[model samples]
Target: MKITTLTNPRQTILLTSRAGNKDNVMTLDWHTPLSFEPMMYAVSIAKARYSLELVRSSKVFVVNFMSCQFEKEVLYCGRHSGKYIDKFKETSLEREEAETINCPRIKQALGYLECQVQEELEVGDHILFVARVSKAELREKGKRLFHLFADKFTTTEE
Candidate 1:
């Protein structure tokens, strides 16, 4: 069985976090809503990823729902890394303070959920971070980007 086939054509999201002076955003496709009552959200990030380290130290992250307009920015963040460059500056994505967390959310996002880390576990090559949503914000609705496996991404409006 191919892992690519298993995780194909998934809705993508932007995961943001901050550690000290370092803030970063990364394209995430392995995320889901776990519960409604407690407003739980989970994201599976590779342990070796830079964003994972920031999230681990900060214990907070913002899940930004990007519109189709941000497909280029998403690919840039996913392709590069925060270790060598400032993603916010490089991508020119505006960062705004999260409601209940120290991290920042993408200002251009259609919606966002600010989360505080509740639990984490090492699952295979990735670390599953389950967080409780402390606050959320939604602006004018728009089409969202969905990764269609490989280098392909389509918009929700399509």
Candidate 2:
């Protein structure tokens, strides 16, 4: 077993970013709340990821906390790249304008955090974007998707 899988059952999210007319969404589990006073967050993206470029250039993103039912769509976004195809058009997920950031948010998300990038640090193979939660919304309540391993998942106990 890969050591990385030790961090199993992590809550997954869809990160949205837009640069110019291009909007992108990517599946992410590597995120954390940094501070409560300022409402800060951090998400690590691979250096080669297409979404990283969008978030970097735009300095904004939306963290879409997805429901467990959207696992298929989440996996699709993770497998494909926005550079080669339009993820929003391909998936059943609907794109909606975020309240604070320029990026779009998923209409089906349980909640979302509109973030404005405050800093970027290169961490090994990933770039960690530290952002301030400019706005947040809880659209719905449901079991959230959790990634255990490739093609394997779990959900919060209801």
Candidate 3:
């Protein structure tokens, strides 16, 4: 049997946002649940990324959990920059207004976590946005898509 050692563990998701009418999406593997009372979550995005700038200015974002059907869209959004192209238009995913935040949520996702930035920490190449969950909705209880080894995408059994 071959055993593999893993250091970091997180399910990559599409962090979508819009700032001043500019909408963008970024792939983020750095995310974790921070609290349960207020339902806080955190995501780390590089300062140079387009989504980071949007989140910084808007102070809000939607964490959309991808499904197995969105593998192509995930890769496209992750590899391409929203500054040059419209990611939403490129992908088949749909967007909807969040209940509490100013950002938009992916309507096709199994669920969404809407948040408002609570704190930001400057970490080496990325800025950690610790946000307080303003609202959450589970449209479907399907499996969640995850990225491993930076390329492979897999789904969890529900």
Candidate 4:
């Protein structure tokens, strides 16, 4: 009887944001498109997460779609905290300036969506951020990463 397993095979993404001079990236499995009329997106982030405050203050974030090649980076970001180390520096994940937002996007990501926070509400221990897509970058097609409980990942590659 494992609840985590029930939510298995979920999409994994790298949520990036910048508050003033600080930038951070975290692995997120709880996010989705909430609307189509206005092209809205939402992400569920814990209150204690370092990126929560950054997103709150900056009111902007980028969702980086990682491919199977970035599995190591995805896992590394999930295991480490931005409060302790510079994830980009430690992981050597390159960054590129987002077109519509002040934050940066992962250069290695298969694609990226720049979002501006439109609304926020508390959902239990997590804050649900509703955002509007301001810009997007789609790179070469690749296998997207999906979380399959714990440290396991499933991809469309093979």
Candidate 5:
């Protein structure tokens, strides 16, 4: 295993966005908090991802924090393509309008951060979207899902 495997169990999120009337969601694990005062967050998406184009065109997205209960849905979203199939239609996941951004948030998510893209930088094979949190909320109490390497996942004990 790579040393970065030590970073295993990174928080798993469903990045939701909209292009015109079409809504899209994708499973993502490479994201982080950037600022505090303005409450910024960043997510790294590959250039070929359909959601990347949607995010670029819409300039906004919702980081829907999922829980362990939705691991199957998470894997489904990650393994499939929004260009070919409707993720929501294929999975049990439900969506709702974000508080600030004009995108959808996962209803089954433990929480969500509606963000507006502040900057986009080319980071090797991925585009890093730096965003300012326009709205944030915790829907309920649950242990967040974490991605560990490939098909493995874990969650907090409590």
Candidate 6:
């Protein structure tokens, strides 16, 4: 059952933080590691998503690991659009400047991976951003929050 397996996979709300005069954060569910050497990852974002444009123009983003504590913020980011509301200001999620990249990182997250978009492939309603991880930092060594079917939450062992 592809649907069942997909629903059960360890899914984290991948937050892609953009860089610019005004930053934008987008919540993504379709993301995966593409390669291990040099640490490459790919994230699929709908073409209509405002953050997708921001990330494409900047070619850099930060992947923040969402925790259970940020469940509300995560849902808000996914539901709302950056074109209208300022998700960051509305959610009041503190942001810190990333070390290796210009994008901002969610301070509330357990850890973050700063990346630079190396390539992009347009696929259906979404565009896949192939990125190279530039830097990573773990604020706390704890379990990671995840999503499952039926709108359930789970965590992974440390």
Residue pairs with clashing backbones, model 6 = none
User: Candidate 6, residues 19-118: lDDT per residue as tens digits?
Assistant: 4677777777688888888899888888888988789888998888877777677777877898887777999688788888777888888888888999
Report how far off residue 44 is in candidate 3 (Å). 0.3
lDDT of 3 by residue, 73-126 (tens): 888898999999989898898888888877888988888899999999999888
Q: Which candidate is the best by TM-score?
A: 2
Using Cα atoms with residue i matched to residue i, what is each candidate's TM-score against the true structure? Answer: 0.96, 0.97, 0.92, 0.95, 0.96, 0.87
Point out where model 3 deviates above 4 Å.
1-5
Query: How many pairs collide in each candidate, listed in order?
Result: 0, 0, 0, 0, 0, 0
lDDT of 2 by residue, 8-64 (tens): 778999999999999999999899999998999999999989999999999999999
Q: How accurate is candidate 5 locally (lDDT)?
A: 0.92
State each model's CA lDDT, in order.
0.90, 0.93, 0.85, 0.90, 0.92, 0.79
TM-score of 4: 0.95
What pairs collide in candidate 1?
none
In model 2, which regions exceed 4 Å deviation?
Answer: 1-3
lDDT of 4 by residue, 52-123 (tens): 989999999999999887889999999898988899899979988898989989988888889999999999
lDDT string for model 1 (1-87, tens) is: 768687767878999999999999999999999999889999999978999989999999999998888888999999888999999
Query: In terms of lDDT, which candidate is stronger, 1 or 5?
Result: 5
- Where in model 4 is the C-alpha error above 4 Å? none
Output the worst ten-in-a-row residue range by lDDT, candidate 4: 2-11
